[model samples]
Target: MNYNESLEKLLSLTDSERVSGRGQHTRRYDLTRMRVLLDELGNPHLNTPTVHITGTKGKGSTAALIASVLSSQGYKPGLFTSPHLHTFRERINFDGEPITADEFAALIEDIWPVLTSINHDGSHGFITTFELLTAMAFLHFERKKAGFQIVEVGLGGSLDSTNVVQPQVCVFTSISLDHTAILGDTEEKIARDKSGIIKDGCVVVTSPQQPQVMNVIAQACQDHGTAFVQSSEECTCTLSSADLYGQNFDIVAPWGEFSFRTPLLGAHQLENATTALVTLQVLNELGFTVTSDSFARGFRSVQWPGRLEVLSEDPLLIIDGAHNPHSIGKLKEALHDYFQFRRVVYVLGFSSDKNISAMIQELPYDNAEVVVTRSRHPRSASVETLASEFSRLGVSVKQLDTVNEAVQYAMDLAQPDDLIAVTGSLFVVAEAREFLLNIPPELYPSLDAGMPIR
Candidate 1:
């Protein structure tokens, strides 16, 4: 079968095994099963130098930054992230390019038989869908002989499938209250889970976090005998020209200083940049030697999608995948700082578990017209429920059953000088961009087209 066809089959398998493979309803967090599976596959995750990134807000962006830096240093970098916006291939990439269909199918096929044995062994439980994807990425990176691999944790780092790798540098972006049902309700609790990626003797890099969260990471580093570096105390990022297109910033860290301009937005990205800079510094300290020129090249060429992505100029169309409250708060700040419009029209949808009401409340536009919609996901929140929540905020709200309808409604309501921002969930932004903005589904790889991932 072809790439798309194969991927569809793979997804079907995941759906079929959802009752056993997915941990959505359970509190199952065991690495033994995945560890056994990885051991069976020869532990491909151990074959490359790695940087493991974890956090609530900026882990994805930090991973992109670190990978870009590695690429600039003349290293064939491997990047494994999650929840692809358009295509499944987006989850695994090398040197900033998605893995080819042929390679993906071959890799998955090679692992399928062994994976079945491990899954059916009953020694532990079944392998999760994410665990299989992690295995695929590791195997591909090993086969390609990548120099460095950037792996973003799927959820709480402690038991995340990607945590199987022993990373040279462990980076934690800003921690916030999210995934309370799984990670816990308190900031300290979440921080402790995120700090799980901090391995013994690995260099830990992080931005200044809440005092409570910082304590948790500091304690973890101490327990592991790891050197912990904080961005606010040990690294500084000065951002300028952070507009709709991209950003220019200077990252000064304990190891050295470098300046770079990236195709990402928001001052919040500076924290992500700081984390990456420290990771690069640690890489150099570990004999990687990523020089100043390489630093400039890497960041300048770096691209992420969806985060404040400018889709149009006439009506000022912007799309942000701010599914969580913390990310939505950052989106609000970016919008307020960068652009001004006569009117704002928000195209919003979210998953059922997300605090959609809190997101709408925190978004910058109270006076902006709101169009509530449902993303093409099994867990999407109903448009009417979201619309009613927005109504309580006294915002003029309209409910559209689908993302496409919401996009059309916003576009029709928007004037030449007005702005239409699509957000709430990555799925919503992806579906809207694909169907409304005419992005071919196959080519639309990531939500973060030219932004930082964390």
Candidate 2:
């Protein structure tokens, strides 16, 4: 079968959403079926060294940075992430390229019959689409002879499908209040869930998380007898987020102090870069030597989209996937910290389960105009619902049915110095970016290309 046809067939065979629904029921919290499926595929995950990353916000960026550093260190790395902005193949990468059509075809041919046989029997061995995809990734990376595999948790860590791998190093970026429905609303509860990836004798690395969250991780490390490394105080970096390209004032690390610059704008990204640096340092201490030159080369080349990405030049169209209250708070702070505007225009959309009102409240829109919109997702909250919420907040909102319409409306009101920020859901930001920048979603290869996987 062709690539798209094969993916369609696999997606149709089982409910893809069930893969990410583990947090709903403990009965479904086991990985036996996925393990068996991988065994049938020759247990590819066991063939490669692995790094597992789990966190509320920075997991994607952290995984990308680590994989990039590994590539710079002359290792062929494989990266697997989630919720592709364009194609399903984006979830898997080999040597920094999205799996080709021929590769996807070969992978599906190998796994499809096995999945069919398991489903035909009366066994409770059903695997979700994400699990199947994860299995496919293991098979792909193993076939490509990867030096290392960087895996990002699809959801909260404890029962996430990607947790099946025993990682060489387990890294948690930061714990936040997102996914409260599944992981509980408290920071402690969420921290406990993220700490589930720590195994005995493994090295644990973390950024400067909240005090409560840090305590949870520390307790987990002690309980598991794992070596835990927090961000070094001297590894701090200062960030200057100007309207144009931002400058990262990098401080000295275990290797040494050095400043690096990138197009990534925002203070949160600076923190993320530090988290990646500390994690790499832990990896080095574990005998994986990544030199300062390799680190600098990778840091400058790493590209993580849909996070404070600037798409246009004149009016400065910014895109961020700030779906939760904590991330939105950071987004608001970045907006106020970097640029001053006569009037700001916000094009926002969110999922039905998200804290829409809370996120909207956190947005720094004192003198700004808000345009509410809905993205192309099954769970997208209606524009009217957002309009009503903003109305209750005593903020006038303009309603648009889609991100494209909302963005155009915002641009119409934008002046030369005015700024337009599109945020709320990654789905929304993805759609807005495709429209405003005219980058066809299908043309952007995959999430794997963004990571230097393999």
Candidate 3:
């Protein structure tokens, strides 16, 4: 099959990423099924030096940073992340560029027969769409002869499809209460689920987390006989200055002290940078050639889109995918620290399953004008639902049916000194970005280009 044909067949399968409601819990997320599928595919995930990362937030950014460092160290690194904002090919990249359309289609075609056979057999149960994508990524990385592959966990780490590989180094970003209905309601419960990525005898790196959450991760490392390293204890970051464009900071790590200026915003990113730096340090100890100069070059050049991304300067538009309360709180703090504005305009959208009430409370909407809208995503919450939630919070809200409409309305109302923030969901931020940046579908070669995944 061709690229478009293969994409159609892939979309025809059941995609849990686009599904909503508690029924998601009923679907099996078994790693055994994933293992069987990979085994049938010749176990492509094995014998690869991998860096596995998982957490509630900042894991994607951390993975991107690690891949950047590996690339700087003269290694061909493959990066696999999830829930692409603009294109499906964004989920898979080698040496900072997305896999070409032909490459993606070739991988899909290569795995089609095995996927069909597994579905036809009853004992193996049907594999998830994500599982197929994971298998395809492993095969693509191995075929391309990547020096290292950086994999990010899709959901809870234990039963996640990407858990099949034994990583050379494991990194965990901050853990928080997200996916509560599926994972658990408390931080400790969620931490236990994330700690599942810790493998026996591997070195695990983490950012500073809550004491309870830290205890859970530490206990998991002990159980697996893995060495745990905390970024906060091993390194310290002091922010010298920050603005909407980026931030400058000094990191004192075990190797030595280094200063970095990054286009990625927020003080929270300091933790992510530290986590990536420490992971690179661990890789160096494992006989890798990453040096402080590599860290310096990579840390400054990494690009993680849609997380505190500043798109425009005239009206000061910032788009972030802060879907949950914990992330929204960080977004609010970043906004306060980065920009000086006369007024703030919040263009908000969220999925139906998100804690809309709690997320709204965390947003800095006390003195800001709120515009509620829905993205093109199937699971996006309705404008009426969001408007009602805003009203309940004693905030006046303007309801718009689509993300583009909301962003245009905010722009029309804002002054040059006012800030316009498109947030609450990555889907919403994706739409706003396309509209504001005037990106055309032709910009990406994939047939499914400019389409939001999940």
Instruction: Please tell me which predicted candidate would have the highest TM-score against the true structure.
Output: 3
Q: What are the RMSDs of all candidates, in order?
A: 4.2, 4.4, 2.7
Worst 10 residues of 1 by lDDT: 445-454
* lDDT for residue 446 in candidate 1, whole number 0-100: 24
The best-first sequence of candidates by lDDT reads 3, 1, 2
User: In candidate 1, what are the lDDT values of residues 199-293, reduced to their tens digit?
Assistant: 89799988878889989999999999999887678777887566668888886665677678888788888777777777787788889888878
Best by lDDT: 3
lDDT of 3 by residue, 1-454 (tens): 7777667656656567865331222356677778888998889898579999999999999999999988888898999999887777788898899988899899989898888887778475676667778988899899989999999999989888899999989888999989998789999999998888889868999989999999999999999999899999999999998877788999997679999888889988988998998999998888988988888888889999899999988888999999999999999998888889888999999999888999999976656999999987768899999988988878899999988899999999999889999999988988887888886422222213333454
Alpha-carbon deviation at 255 in model 3, angstroms: 1.7
The 10-residue segment of model 3 with minimum total lDDT is 441-450
Evaluate residue 53 in candidate 3 and report its C-alpha lDDT on the 0 to 100 scale.
94
Return the TM-score for each candidate structure: 0.92, 0.92, 0.96
lDDT to native, each model: 0.80, 0.79, 0.86
Candidate 1 runs further than 4 Å off: 12-27, 253-257, 364-366, 442-454
lDDT of 2 by residue, 316-412 (tens): 7889888899889988888888776677899989888888888988976677889999876656789989988988889998999978899999988
Model 2: pairs clashing at backbone N, Cα or C within 3 Å: 77-453, 77-454, 78-454, 90-447, 95-453, 95-454, 252-257
